[model samples]
Target: MSGESAKGQKSYTNALLRLENITKAFGNTKVLNGVSLTVGAGEFLTLLGSSGCGKTTTLRIIAGLERPDSGRVFLEERDITYSEPNKRDVNTVFQNYALFPHMNVESNVGYSLRIRSVNKVEIKQRVADALRLTRMDEYAKRMPTELSGGQMQRVAIARAIINRPKLLLLDEPLGALDLQLRRRMQIELKRLQRELGIAFIYITHDQEEALNMSDRIAVIRGGLLEQTGGAAEIYDAPRTSYVARFVGSANILRGVSALSSLLPNEIIAVRGENIVMEPYSEQSRGLKGVVTDKRFAGGMLRISARLNQSGAEVVSSRHGIDSPLTPGQSVSVSWDAASEIVVKDNDTGEVS
Candidate 1:
């Protein structure tokens, strides 16, 4: 279990875990449907989806918390499909810090080692090392109630990694924190993963979270893998309408005559930021639309307009906070041909 395998497949020759055609069901509802995934050594891969979309179930299978009805789980060329959780070289950090309320930080972090009958001297050294890695060494004696959300999370991580597991699974580990704190923890987690050189399998339903931390993201929908790629690839060239619509704010144009040369019934998607909005003029080029609504976001002004020809709502974004647009005002919306992507169609819709 501690050795590497040369049989690792695909673009990664050093994958730490592989699940082939994993299937699971509860009663009659199939939670996971032949889902296959691979985590490269020291790579940050996120399983992203909404609730009951099989993301959590997938993570549980990898951690041996839940057994897949069918499929093979491999770790370093060895089949661990039916292996007990304790026998696997993996650890899981759940959203609920799950820290023992009665235990101090140091005790909580060293509990695993103590349970295994590790020598007290070695336990102390490993606990200190894990705490230092997570930057929680200074708070080693603090009680769980005395620590903030982020601090408690660090302690939880320290406990999980104290054994130096080959792979770490995180199930929405930041779901409980506020937005600002969550963002900060996201950075901290990514940095820790890089510093430890341990493969991280993170799970989250938040698109921004996955995009922010993952080296690659696997988007799951309705118990199926929707798309898997880097943040930019998944955003810029989504293979399906669901991915385009779910991953970001997209304006799906279906048979919008104002947009030229569109195939019949073809559904094209354009990111809000990609659409250029300008004041309407007699000679203004591009598709014509009437501004229906405008709102101010963090760094951009989001505008919603109704296409004159197709009556379809198209959203566009303007940088900064200056907006002269009012409801019922006319405007021109256009984007570069290269920026437009075909996501889906009613019949024979193509993706490129």
Candidate 2:
């Protein structure tokens, strides 16, 4: 999809949550600096950023776990900034499963309803429904210790959704699982969000996770929102160098005088897969470079080349099992002009 249409998808008539000028500081360190955002009802929005970028703090503020030093939080137009966590209609699932070892899966999932004095019949029905939604009905009698990490995560999600909150906050909930399991859980989580039809505010530093599952992605940097758009919009047209590099792998070409199309201050970012590398020939029209390294990455081969004129390293990916190019082999690198992305350099230098 084009960036324009991707951005247009964020215009919502019914906003479920709104954060206005939220700011929080811990002693001399300011964690959130006037961060503002909105979550639409039944939308899946992800807070994407590296560690210490205030994404987690933003999630906590919305959950009422951490009150903002300044600004207001509104849930369905109701002011809930100073409300207690339990008082608000929001639930959180942390990275650690944090399941009760003494309780079985059914008891853990139904604990919230039980504490509220819900009748046994209603509680049991709700618990059963939650387990079935999370595909953990078969494991209801199992304890936390007997279940795997993925199962424990499912239980945590089930517990969070048992009360049917208006919004759910997930703080890197898939960080504990292995690669294969994490990928599978990503699909499962998206499906669960769709089935529940509730707003989900997910936190993650992994760009792939954000791109795969989020309806919209908000990229945070230096305690500020750098960019917010759909996955394709963020990947195709990043507004700044920090965002371009953070969202995906890009060949950032800076100070390349050879490209006359770019302004003096602007830099170019090309995706590895968009770049084409071929063996050098006398009739070659692209930049001459030598292959510096090559490696096999599952389904694709990644080749790194160093330009002879500018001495800048470039990486290109091709779909194949092996490449004939070897280290020190002469090659030419080129890409379509439409593939080049011109982005502004980050002046703050606060992005990690």
Candidate 3:
């Protein structure tokens, strides 16, 4: 949800990390062009997009793993564009976990302290504390080979948090896990992050994961950032056609906004779940539609229909009802007038 009131409050912008006019190129092809974004302190931010969209590159720039051709980076109001990875007060947990197979969990967790010449007593205490935070203390003596997938992730997180970095960068850290494990880890990760109070910059192509875990998400496409906002704001109030279609399943239809008073003049919108399929003559103020098809989708029944009055296609689903809805049923689909979002031409799918 947006951290502001409706009636269009001013957008919040107290950035913790700022990227100004960042540009990157591989030979002649530009990977990132004047890309800019800011991450708020203690907020879980997810940089989301398909491959080749520069989200990974942007994460790399923050980690000091990749240098940008142009622009400056500021972390906590301090310029750190040219700072080495070792000097930056941050830790990166990559998709691969990047843990050393040769090292035990405790050594891997305490490596940074050990390299800094921290006394053995201090390193032991810190590593033990970090392991306890991830609930991996029992696995401290085990090698990376002996740990389960979830246990390995915990170890990796333990390693990253051991040093108490000011920021944490997660690039598809949960991509490899099975569905059950990923779901479990996501909950654990979110809890741990909230407890630690360190800002997180996460990267992922999974929109659901981004929405589920992040305070806000940045959607990028073709090396350009399309939009950034909280999960509800972005999902319920998409700013672009790509965002609408990508974030969820949507039926895009073209119509004259001026002609249809009921249909949302806005771009693509999946039919809201709250819309009642049954018709009422007195209070029928929604889009005039006809039921075209309905199908059982696991626990819920999905209904696809077309607007008879406006000729627009609509896709909706009904859940929790054991009775089945018939096909080609007559229904006047309706939506709240105030809930209809107005998107720009570029943001809305083109008429063509």
Candidate 4:
């Protein structure tokens, strides 16, 4: 699902937006520290992380809603670090939708044009085009109060895109919808982006959302970019323990427990999907373990094991196929050596 290879072929000069060493702080607390990133033209790049991790703050900085303490922002090679929001060629879609309750869909979609003193005839045509692009043309006469959450979202998008901005910043715009609705919107949003051929800087804490919709995802932590790559690259080869655990469920084996002389002092990160629970055999390539816990987790059977070599606990999961695994059972845990991700200890500056 990663578009990294496709995006890698392009040159940096073609980036639609660039953030250089962006830093921001609220009083004594630093919210963003030297964050830098780039979004290619028509690419869907997601800023993915937990709350207060600076994803939203970064998006606001790019939108000109919040200025950074230091750093520069470029749009189409033009430095707009201090440009007014209105003058920038960008639009933002927030989580709240922020539509005018008193206005109908057409009026709301054409609000920007109206504020610019555009002719009524031209505004009407643009509004119609925007509404049609979002497939909400039939609901043009409906008020915000009467429209469903999805419909309201469509209307908001129509309004944001009516200006045909160079870049669109979506700040958790789908966070308010139900799970099913949110999933549907994810697909619709991606399709719309491809059709519009405009770059999107989407912000979300949901890993699934980021993987599902992003061409590339930037994982932020402590006001800095922790890792950035396609979903597969980030998942299969996380640069740090934090990213491996945060991006998905992982079983980390450290020190002597990892049983890897190549990185004897480092922590080995193995994803749950990569670990397999099987009967003991001389040909088995991983650590010997004893099953300590087992549970049915939706579609997979999650098994927890304590490694015999170092007594460290590790988790593995298998698809439901009537496995005989049970608590107190002796089982071997094995995985491909290529799947073990080496992560360093940031505090100690050690490989572990």
Q: Which candidate is the best by TM-score?
A: 2
lDDT of 3: 0.76
lDDT per residue for candidate 2 within 28-127, as digits (tens), equals 8999999989888778899999999999999999998899999999999999999999899899997787898999999999999988999999999999
lDDT of 1 by residue, 139-256 (tens): 9889999999989999999999888788999989999899999998899998788777778899998888988988889998778888899888988888777778777767777655
Which residue pairs come into collision in candidate 2? Answer: none
Model 4, 1-352: lDDT tens per residue? 1222333423334778889999999999999999989888778898998898899999989888999999999987899999999999899997899999999999999999999999999999999999999999999999999999889999999999888787889999999899999999999999788777777899998888998888889999889999999888887778877777777667767544444544434577888878888876778776788989888785678888998988878888754646787888887888877777787544222221
Query: What's the best-to-worst order under TM-score?
Result: 2, 1, 4, 3
The whole-model C-alpha lDDT of candidate 4 against the native structure comes to 0.84
Q: Please give the range of 10 consecutive residues that has the lowest summed lDDT in model 3.
A: 1-10
| C-alpha local distance difference test of each model | 0.83, 0.87, 0.76, 0.84
Clashes of 2: 0
Evaluated with lDDT, which candidate comes out highest?
A: 2
Error of 4 at 185 (Å): 1.1
Off by over 4 Å in 4: 1-13, 262-265, 279-293, 296-298, 306-311, 328-330, 346-352
Better of 1 and 3 by lDDT: 1
Model 4: weakest 10-residue lDDT segment is 1-10
Which scores greater on TM-score, model 1 or model 3?
1
